[model samples]
Target chain A: MSADSPAGTHPDPTLTSLDIGHPVYAALLDPDTAFWALVDKTRVADTLAGGPLRDAYRQHADACRRELHALRFELKPSGVYLNPTERCNLNCRYCYLPESQRRSGGHMSVDQLLASLSRLRDYFRSIMPEGGRPRAIFHGAEPLMNRDAVFAAIDAFAGDFIFGLQTNGTLLDDGAVSFLTARNVSIGLSLDGPSAGITDATRHTWSSRSVHNRVLAAMNRLRGYGSWSVITTCTTENLPYLTAMVELFHAREVPTCMLNAVRCTLAGARDVKPDDGAMSRAFFAALDRTHELYRDGGRKLVVANFANILIAILAPTARRLMCDISPCGAGRAFFALAADGNLYPCSEFIGLPRFKGGHLLADGGIEAALTSDAFRSVIGRNVDAFSPCDQCVIRHFCGSPCPAEAHEMNGGMTSTGVFCAFYREQVNYALRLIADGKADDYLWDGWDDGTETLIDLAH
Target chain B: MTQTVLTKPQTQRASSPSPAVAPAIAVRKTCNPDGVGLSHYVLMDKKVAR
Candidate 1:
């Protein structure tokens, strides 16, 4: 971050790339402790024997080494997840929330919710050096379940905080859409697949209604309106239909989509999780097909998971994803606020009691929570600290693995996550995409990921 | 400049423009903190090797 030369501002035009007739290969590298450099090596070696080109290459290489020698991980959290209620309407089999919290029917009153938000505001103001306006996400269980508190939070902080909502999409009515869109709140909807058979197999509603049909209706209402996206969780049953799902997203006019693997939890729905190779291959097909479909069109389509991975590999410092990054945003970049003013690393860490940082309403809460043993353990983790990861060729690209997921599946954060194989496949596929000259399709530069890291596609 | 020309078995996949021309190659040796070799690799062609 302290680099004297900013990205995309290299003075010499020839420094960015060699004009060799052959195709140039580029990758980020940390050469040695002696050189003390971090470089996006374009690999224009001195094969010219003796010439002006060879001298120019060496000059550019030396300049590259001197320009960027260090990287800073400044955690500027983009959003805070507020769970007004811990109760969801539908019982999705793959839902990772502990069954107890799901059934507890715990809801925070409007007063308590406001108090927690105010305290959080004070805490954030004290910490954020750059002065950022972080968004508030209505998340956990079903945020819409207690609509009153959700509205109150927005009303109170609309001037100070941006707003977004993550919902199952079945409950979106015209009134809700109108209100949310009016305020420019980003809406994130969830659907398992394109059709009912794929979705209803696991997402069971109490009223026995079809989940896919309800969500599709909402999508129809949401099209060409507010800032909205869809998240379709991929499980064992829906692996074969990955391409179809992305196509449906494009067809339905959903601007962005993310495919997530079913999380491995202590409760165990292991059978539903797809194998890494299967998921990766299926995901590749989806991405390739979507690229062709959306390329020439007036509209744009973004596959969120693919884009996040690209950002991680291509622009590591500018990564905005909560998961996947080493020492993932959990206790670092963001935190999840439970209904009763409790602070968890993230919504996914809600059910696990051991991972609770502290209650936000407590005195000296922000400092206490951040300094907790669990929080320290999570925040201090890096790829170089562990095995298999330390030796892994793509450790930097992979960010090691999701520690919370690893702990849930393997009983220790040090052990790799259950989805490590699938994740590895994703990293390798991203590299292949870069090699094939198709990486720009998913390299998103729009996110305010708390870094000035510019995406330099010059080479 | 020295241009080394060589030939090898062809793959079923599409070939580059000049397969007969021996590709420019570089062997990058990675050393761990202790200066021990981790692996042996000499990259020939980026497009094919990747």
Candidate 2:
């Protein structure tokens, strides 16, 4: 068999690039060794001629094919980010939602929300009979703005799904806390940092009131309620305070913190977006602080990004269903149900007409919406279809550069210019952490063996 | 469940299926104990010691 030949008739889309600096990486790059020995097994004619090594390689390839087939077909939608209302009380400068959409004051009617939930329940039942509970995350400009609607949907779907809320936290008064606590709903508070200087710089209400104190107070009020996490949008303004932010979350005993890079959207203000180099530096620094808090400070703070990357390295299937991965799991495994009852591939694609999957009508339901051209277009974008991604070493586990980010930055899904460097840097960092054996320090060790089973099925 | 077949793009490399198992290799070097590796985690493909 020739060295250049593929190992199978169809190239496995799940092939990931190893950390090049790692010894395993060098071995794979060499064509002669068993490290990349499977590469030559693609020569079907030669394999049929019968060698023990070739037979073993062929057996492994067949297993991979079967696993890939199941991943592409049988994976069900894990959760839905349901927008209860597009209207947010806080008018943050870096808000990604189109101003028009945010200003529309649209709220998902209780009937509409219930209908969507019913449809989702039916779909889940059809796909996974024993999958147990599905999840619905109530999100919006401020999901708390339509508190009644959020509660109604929660009460209606409480038995059928696990409930979660992502709120600006300014609206979480005693009443809101009691309501959330009663339902045992997991809540994610958006607080840029602990200090007023950091938080008030960007996050504020429409009336120009600084929401820093209110959000902090809310965090304090809801401390003991269900699971609580923090989501901070990393912008230029908050870059310097990243370590301080992690410290704040750790101090507050917040278990998880998600430092999401400010995505460059058409509606995003230019001044708010941090430069790529600066963002990368700040992110790494914050990650270091997080590790220190865990290792030295003995804090149980989990940085979601690093934790997710650890999961990706140890478990491939966990990465597969994530939205960042190639052939993004957006429209397929997960989607955003907008306030207007319109289905979007994800929250990022909510206002974009090109990505509108279908409407969750009262009578017609969500099945037809799943098959819409918009939905199909997103679900159809496999890693093999992407240009540089097909050749990318980290293609399998790198989340394949967000397609939404690609479209926003370069006007199409084919170009990954916006997040390519950022992803590469972060992925390499995660790989380094794993190589150094410090990954477990920052990660929650409670991950079930289900991920391992999934990886075995696929890779 | 109806399987949505993912169409392989024409630009994809004509190769064999990806190896299902991770390659076996020993750890050559560990990063600094102080976690200094975090700061230098940027892509270092060319500088890799063979």
True contacts kept of each: 0.00, 0.00
Badly placed stretches (over 4 Å) of model 2 are: A1-69, A319-321, A362-364, A449-459, B1-50
User: Where is model 1 chain A poorest over a 10-residue stretch in terms of lDDT?
Assistant: A31-40
The alpha-carbon interface RMSD of model 1 comes to 17.2
For candidate 2, write residues A144-194 as lDDT tens digits. Answer: 888998898888878887777888888899998888778778777888866
lDDT of 2 at A361: 64
Query: TM-scores across all candidates?
Result: 0.77, 0.78
TM-score of 2: 0.78
Model 1, A340-457: lDDT tens digits are 7778777777777787888887876867887788677766666556777765545554654566667777777787667766776776566545544465566443333233322122
Quality of candidate 1 docking, DockQ = 0.03
Q: Backbone clashes in each candidate structure, one number apiece?
A: 0, 9
Give the per-residue Cα lDDT of candidate 1 at A99.
66
